[model samples]
Target: MLADFDDACGKIGLQLNLTKTMFMRNGWVPDAPFSLNGTNISECSSHVYVGREVNMMNDLAPELGRRKRAAWGAYKSIEDVVKKTKNIRLRAHLFNTMVLPALTYASETWTLRKQDENAVIVIERSIERVMLGMTRLTQVRAGIRSSTLRQQSKIRDAAVYAKSSKIRWAGHVMRLNDHRWTRAVSDWTPRNVKRTTGRPSIRWSDFFTKSFKERCDALRVSRTDRTHWTTLARERDKWKNCWRPLGLPDDQRESRSRSRSSWALVPPRKQEAGVNLSFGVQSSNKRSFLHFLSNIKTVSVESIFETAFTV
Candidate 1:
């Protein structure tokens, strides 16, 4: 036990003290005064002693001052680095904990297999959005680019990936264990097989693939819905006439999408390229991929969602 204790302490550079000291001795009252008189006055006399209550207090100021100075110097050295920091969320995600490990399992077992490309795309786009907003906000708030927002977004993306990964893993376990859920989908089960009670189930593909696709599709749908809201709100006059034929109320379209306390401001949507009859070129009519890519970190095609979509 002693050896193990010392070894553990050594790993974190902890110190041990076993020296005999005045404080450890009996009758060493730390804050009390002492008095002394001539020993010859009386053999039965109890002498009152007077001296410094605590000499260590006087002696330790210099040591304390040195420690304070060292700490301040160390803190100031990282002042510039801290000032340039952005994502607060990423820091929490990188820390080791039970929740983080679960997320890791989920990402590896499920989310990674199917929607790895989409995850990369979402992360890249999210970074660009944050950076663009931060750049403008920083210019106004601090009168300079005091922090690199792109760097922070990467941290946030990494954290999100960790969390999403774990969710995918957990979901895989839940799906396998649920008897009714698995049995409901016969196609998912193999042919020429008979089921026994409490039989173990195996997922053929990576668990993350389906989970990743679901998450990506949901995000895409949300973006599309918001885009439609923006179009309707902006072109209210055109919407009144055009959308009325499709049974959408002209007067309630704007109010239906918003509330008194909440106003819906649309974010820029990523565009996929397809041939347009109105234009001679095969180009995206919405946001340009390169323009958005420049704001984020990497420019890999796999990281961007501008791939050709087929029906």
Candidate 2:
């Protein structure tokens, strides 16, 4: 392939820069010897192309760390302004507009996992703590701050923002005709190629599919409608709200526990005698059984029995 490329370039009066070029393998394939114009082309585990690092194993830790460092630098540049600003909103605005873009540059292309999300959240929470002038120690001591507090304000999680950006990009790509390279590559699958052993690497499209289902339940009905999909993607506030932390207040937690206990004590609804009941057995031992049932949609008694016994 390199020889053919070199030949084609020569025909067009162009030269291949072997010094600047790198070859990378997509999967767990051993490196093969290759040369371009008698110069050996080095194989690399990863390479930075168009500003984003493309890794053979699809690991984003290095890239994410780089972004975090860049973001910290950006924040440091405006740290004085952030500290002196009387308005919390102004500080937040500055962080969002100036620092976040640096942190999340090219995030749309990332295949994020739970660990990646947690890492981004840690950085974000650190920034938020800085803005509020509270360290981890102080925050723990403060305990149960009011909702109006600056720290309590629900800032959009960086991982959620990245996922949303990818969804928006996906919608754009889906709108493109079949002839587009982006569209074609998105749907392409290698023929008769077996994956390397062990766990398969996560793909950006897999994240898209999962996130779309979670955030856009109406996706199937609206996907073909470009305007609808666009509207869904543009609802940044809605997406942000959806991604808010699930922590509950102390009072709510206490009430929930009490309610669960009370529900557990309630007599079971009458059922045919001698008909084996899964809940009847579970309720005798597990106080949390009723709590779980409350959250689930109504199911047939027989199906519930089958499920419990199968488990």
Candidate 3:
């Protein structure tokens, strides 16, 4: 790995700071020690790269905290304007464009479990409660619903927004040239690794298949071709929503009904092991080798997800 990196750096007229660039790995695999250019590079438990924290265990708590703090900063930066503005639409728009983006930055790649999703939901609702000028105490006393508050402010659901972003990115990845690492990594299956009995670790791909359960199954079955997918589908007027088996996957639809807690979303049903969706999806085993190459993996995160809005 080091040799290949050194060669690439040499070609690009770049030199890696061996002392500063240490080794970091996700928890999915055992750690492997290494020397760079025959010099040993010290190992570390965790490191922050391009703003997101990566750790040996790939745990998301610290990253969530970082995003939460960033989101708070975004809100506080415009607090006066948002709180003072009488136009609810503008306040909601500001939150969606600024605060939500901070909270969900790089969210498409997140592999969150139910508790994590609930935690994110709580964070969003906390901000939303403030947006509506409703304190936690007042909300509890009045039995106010989260949906009611969001409806007034036109706020989007955090979980739904993140998941739909993933869906969109999946579409973009599906249409990529086969030679691309992002495409190769998405399609790569780990032949050496075997599943241990009992439970399995989560993958980013699970974020899509496990989201809507049977509705997703039906979606893949109906739209077996990539061209029919909302992201890949070019015929917006014809086959755009056609891939959505039940109008919009329930998770993607903004919540409009009264729910005491915004976090009361349905738990994602576990996919039966080895039962792959019919969307021609493959196992994603990117972590084993791709983390070291993430800087050059895709065209750009913004380009991938932003184009989905066009479809």
> Taking the tens digit of each residue's C-alpha lDDT, what string does model 1 give over 220-285?
756444333223323423222221111111122332212212111122242212211111122221
**TM-score-best of 1 and 2:** 2
Off by over 4 Å in 1: 1-150, 158-178, 183-188, 192-204, 207-311
Clashes in model 3: which pairs? Answer: 27-56
TM-score of each: 0.20, 0.63, 0.69
- Which TM-score value belongs to model 2? 0.63
Candidates by TM-score, descending order: 3, 2, 1
lDDT against the true structure, per candidate, is: 0.29, 0.53, 0.59
lDDT of 1: 0.29
> Top model by lDDT, which number?
3
Best by TM-score: 3
Comparison by TM-score, 2 against 3, better one:
3
Q: Over 4 Å off in model 3, which ranges?
A: 7-13, 26-32, 211-213, 216-239, 242-311
Candidate 2: lDDT of 153? 33
